[model samples]
Target: MGKITGFMEYERLEEGYRPVEERVKHYKEFVVGLTDEQAKIQGARCMDCGTPFCNNGCPINNIIPDFNDLVYRQDWESAIAVLHSTNNFPEFTGRICPAPCEAACTLNVNDDPVGIKSIEHAIIDKAWAEGWVRPQPARIKTGKRVAIVGSGPAGLAAAQQLARAGHDVTVFEKNNRIGGLLRYGIPDFKMEKWLIDRRVEQMQAEGVTFRTGVMVGALPSEGPAAKVTNDAKETVSPEQLLAEFDAVLLAGGAEQSRDLPVPGRELDGIHFAMEFLPQQNKVNAGDKIKKQIRADGKHVIVIGGGDTGSDCVGTSNRHGAASVTQFEVMPMPPAQENKALTWPYWPIKLRTSSSHEEGCQREFAISTKAFIGHKGKVTGLKTVQVEFKDGKLVEIPGTEKEWKADLVLLAMGFTNPVPTVLEAFGVEKDARGNAKATTDFIGGYATNVPKVFAAGDMRRGQSLVVWAIREGRQAARAVDEFLMGFSDLPR
Candidate 1:
């Protein structure tokens, strides 16, 4: 909290973006973060609401108010310290997270919430620019080895935490590079890969080893799971990891894409969003891709209207598609939320992303019926208007329609971690097909197999990146406690 009257004086300031026309021409980050003075103004708007719901709303429980106050006081160094205390990687969350913390801001009941995410972005960027983000290498080594399966946020967080605790940590990634979904699945225009690179360098100096192109367990050789990006040149069995490391944490993400198995599913030019997104990312990194997917001059239909779908729209636009259309099965939400009915909680309301502003047709309450194709290639698709009745979606009669398309990208979310990876460790899966692990303090993140643990999307289903970081940090404490009688790591 800063000035008591600041909330009434300052309107929330939004971070700016490069113009749509110019931004679409390149795969560089377009966000123009706030200046120091602007950040201080935003930070001053944080009112001491007695109880900060924003903290609890944040998945990692970042000390939002403290950082806000520090930023207001121009204590940039201390601000980063407070931010880093809870979140291992503020840069990632600051850019891509949906910022549910803002939704829970007390002022959000009547006005715009404090620009918490923008402040965070400013703090971290300033810290890096000032060379304040240095490696915290442990003075003494624990002599214990920890193996983390995955190089995503969860694995990265755990590896960094465990390394700081003096444990010898190794993170295995099946991809050719680090930063799992952050490296591949996310569009480069939203967040450049360099941010991840610098963090990886810091972790390396802290004694965390990263082994890319190495698979922890066998991936499925066929089907949807197989489509998940894998550049593994070397394979290590679960038993090998168990024998070599004192503790093994499976932090692999849910990689199995939810498929649309209607008629003509096998037609060419139909691809999963993951398939299309990653290739562009790889190409941006200067990697040569054979037969890379492109949307130039093609009418594209993107199914699923979540963040992934929005990303598809943006990327398709960047590819200079003739047209872009997105479909969401659920009915459109109201333009504004009834704050009294749903406040201090994430509400269901209409959300238009920056990508939507870039240009695209968004269709709500629509369901794809089948793909239309000729000569073994997808040319268009058929759809029907649907409405929920008795908790079931029913297609309306005479609402059927067909649309032409050259490419159809399925942006439906992921269902679960690849079954083969879980099966390899003999890990039990919950009803949702995620690793069975309770978050109870005693043995949270521990798998059924002795000394084996799981977290992130591998344990929970598809979720935000901040949640993954939280699970990873908590799991680090649990593993440290298991290794020693007690752990100094924060919960």
Candidate 2:
């Protein structure tokens, strides 16, 4: 520990946010990262606790104490090195991750947790500014080729690791861009796209090949999968990849968004959050979309209380929606969690995102029963108040009501990967429809099909980007071992 008593002397400092009025006018990151001195102070707050729970709390198991100590010592270079040791993209997680590590911080038991996330943001930004980030090309070539499907965080992480391990890695993306969900699913206001571009450039320099607009295997042209944004110009059969590459890794995301089967769902102006989100992302990237989903002067109703729904609220507000309201079927969590009961673990508590601060009416314990419309267009929706009784979600009598809404965005989260993609490769699926695979040490990430592996959302369902990176790194080792009978790569 750099300063043993620093935790008791220093107060926690959070990163600042741009004013709501100023930031809502455009789609760009609004967070103001900590200055060097502030970051140093935050790092000093990392106490000499016997065990660092923050490590396990972090999906990638970053060496938090070491980085915190390095930062406290003003070793910016070492801080970034420790950060990059586990996380391939701190810029992505530092910006968008929910910071579960902070929740598990020892200081959080009684006082504010160390501003670990802000410190991480500052470290990475400094690293990039100082040109500390560079491609590390392997000195020796393994001669083994690997094909990874989907260019999201998982696939990108695996590709980078495989390339660094001297294996020829090629990533296939169905979208026209290299970053699958990161390019389209996320809003630019949260993280700019240039970050992904620079990483792609670095990966290319490291001998990783990116094939964009190429769909490996096949996806359904209709139904839930079709709702996901895809701009494939070519289709590569599963057999071709299996034959051409020594190993195949399925790292695509869970693209099948959960749907509401209520009446009037087919009415105009109703769309999945994916359908509405990607269009704005494409538009932000300078692509002109036809009949883009606009919320200007319309009452927008966003269903599901999660990050995706919050993003919809922000985007709708940016489009000058007359009013934006978010709905959650589950009851609202407590404003704060009881630390004594939930220490060293993620806790359930009410979270107010920057989007909520901009403008939004939040509704909890409400479920949409049916859509109300006129002349084939949505006008409103019918909802009922619900409560959990005897472990059942039962609707309360006489609690039915109608709410005005010109547009409805369903953001209830994704169920699993598009079934067609897995089926096309003759891959078996778990009960949840994700690619069936295990995380065992002997043959982790390997699917039921020979020479085929799965990771990230495609194998584990919807999760955080950090988890995707972890799975990708581990799966890469598994694949490497399968190829060379052993792997020197870190787990």
Candidate 3:
């Protein structure tokens, strides 16, 4: 440990955020990163716990202690190296990732956990500023073509790894831009699109070819609708993709957003979070959208009390909505977790995000019974309060109610990847409908179809960006091993 008694000697330093009024006016990141000294102090807080659970707690299993030590020593370059050794995109995780590592810190047993996320954010930002981050183009060419379907974190990570391994990697994104959800579903206010563009530039230098606005394999043009990329300029059949590339990786994420099947779902003002979110991102990227969803002067009701719902709240506030109300079907968690009972793992506790702090009414243990409308448009919603009794949610006897809502955004998470893409490739699907691929120590991540693989949400269903990165990196290693008979890439 760089500082033997640092944990006892120093307190955790929190990151700063821009004033809400100032930040809400525009869609851009407002987090002010820790200073070098503050980062060193935060790093020093990493104690010499016998076992570094923080490392394992991370989805990517980042070398947390080593990077913490390096940052404490003021070796910023070495710190970034240690950080990047496991995390392909610290910039992404450092910003949006819920720091499970911090939750697992030994100090968190009683004291404030080491500010690992803030230190990570500081290290990466410093690396970029000092020109320490650069492209590591392959030293040798393998001449093997790998096709990556989707350009989200999983696809991007896999593409970068494979390309650096000297394989010819081509990433196909159905959207007009390279990043899938990162460039669209996520609000620029949380993380600006430039961060994605920066990584894309580096990936390009590493010999990864990006083919945006291209959909590989057939997709349904109608139905409840899934993975609708209105800007896909061209379509490549499954046969063409399989024949052209030596290997194909299905990295497209879970795009089938779970819907509210209640009546009045067909109302004009109701939309999936995916539908509303992408439009804002498109507009942020200078695309003038027709019939764009607007919350201005409208009472916006966001369902699903998760990160996506919080994002909707922020976006709606920025649009000057008359009011914002969020609903969660489950009972509200305690504001603080019982740490003694939930140490070394993610805790179940209430979390109020920065967007939630801006303004919004949050309703817990509430369920939407039906959407009420007149003249073929939504005007309000019928609701009921729910309670858990004997492990079952039963509506209370007399809590039925109705609330006015001019706009409704459903953010109840995704069900699975679009079926057409997997179906066209003849890949087997799991019971959950994700691409079926085991994470075995050997011959893993391979799909039923020969030379085809799947990773991230495409294989594991809806998950965090950090998990996606982990799957992508591991899948790349598996693909490399299958191709070159061995792989130096880390797990």
Candidate 4:
């Protein structure tokens, strides 16, 4: 620890956001990162605990105490080195990760935990500014080829690891851009697209090939049509990929948005959160969407109380919606969790996102029964208040009500990955439709099919970006060991 008494002297400082009025006008990152001195103070809050639970709390197992100490001692270069040793992309996680590590912080037993995420954000930004972040190309070529599908956090992490291990790595993405959800599903207001672009540039310099707008599976003949990018006019098939590469890793995300099947579900103004989110992101990236879904002057009703639903609320508010309302089937969580009983573990506490702070009415213990519409357009939503009894949700007798809703967005999270892609490759899947694979000591990430591996949301179901990165890094080690009978990569 840089200063043993630092925690007692200085209070915790957090990153600030742009004023709501000013930021709502445009889609841009508004978080004001900490200054160098402020970050040092925050880093000094890390205690010299014999057991660092923060390490286990983090999905990527970041050496939190070491980096915090380095930052406190004003050692920017070493801090970034320690950070990159575990996380391939701290910028993404710093901005979006829920910071479970802080939940496990020893100081959090009573006082606010060390501002670990902000310190990480500061260290990486400083490293970039000082030109310390550079390409690390392999010293020798191994001549092993790897084909990675999907360019999300998982695929990108795996590609970087494999490329550094002297493998010929190529990443294929169906979308026009490299980042899967990070580029589209997440609103640009949370993180700018340029961050992803810079990482892609560094990866390319490190010998990783990126092929965007190249779908590595059979194109759907019918159903909801996919939005095509200007860069490509055609799609690639699974057979073409299998024939071209020595090994394939399926990191494609869980893209299938869970739908609300109810009366008037086919209404015109109702859509999935994925359908509503991507267009705005594309528009922010300077792409012209001809028929963009807008919430301007409409009463928006977002179903589901998760991150995706909050994103819908934010996007709607940005579009100048007349009003917005969000519904959660589960009851609202407690305002505060009993830390004495739930130390070092994630607790069930009410979370209100920045989007919720922007403006919106939130309802809990409520479920939508039907979509009231007219002339094939959604007009309102009929909902009922419910209570849980004996592990069953029972609707209250007289709590059914209808509310005006010109546009309805379903953001109830994804059910599973698109089965066609996995099925086409003949990979066995779990009961939930995720690719079947065991993360064991031997043959980790190996699917039933030889030379095929799976990771990320496609294998573990929909999960956080940090978890995806961990899975990708581990899968890379598994692939390397399988190829060379041994690997030096970290587990």
Using lDDT as the measure, the top candidate is 1
CA deviation > 4 Å runs, candidate 3: none
Q: After TM-score superposition, what is the CA distance of residue 94 in candidate 3 from its true location, in Å?
A: 0.4
RMSD of each: 0.7, 0.7, 1.0, 1.6
* Tens-digit per-residue lDDT, 1-491, candidate 1: 97788999999999999999999898899999999999999999999899999999999999999999999999999999999999999999999999999999998989999999999999999999999999999998989999999999999999999999999999999999999987888999888999999999999999999999998778888888989889999999999999999999999888899999999999999999999999999999999999999999999999999999999999999999999999999999999999999989999999999899999999999999999999999999999999999999999999999999999999999999899989999999999999999999999999899999999999998998999999999999999999987899999
Report clashes for each candidate as comma-separated counts. Answer: 0, 0, 0, 0
TM-score of each: 0.99, 0.99, 0.99, 0.97
lDDT tens digits, residue span 129-163, model 4: 99999999999999889999989999999999999
Query: Candidate 1: minimum summed lDDT over ten consecutive residues — where?
Result: 215-224
**How do the residues 57-108 of candidate 3 rate in per-residue lDDT, one tens digit apiece?**
9999999999999999999999999899999999999999999999999999
- Put down candidate 2 lDDT per residue, 393-473, tens digits, no spaces: 999999999999999999999999989889999999999999999999999999989999999999999998989999999
lDDT of each: 0.94, 0.94, 0.92, 0.90
Q: Pick the winner on TM-score between candidates 3 and 4.
A: 3
Please report how far candidate 4 places residue 106 from its true position, in Å. 1.5
Q: List the residue pairs that clash in candidate 2.
A: none
The weakest ten consecutive residues by lDDT in model 3 span 221-230
Comparing 2 with 4 on TM-score, the higher-scoring candidate is 2
Pick by TM-score: 2 or 3, better one? 2
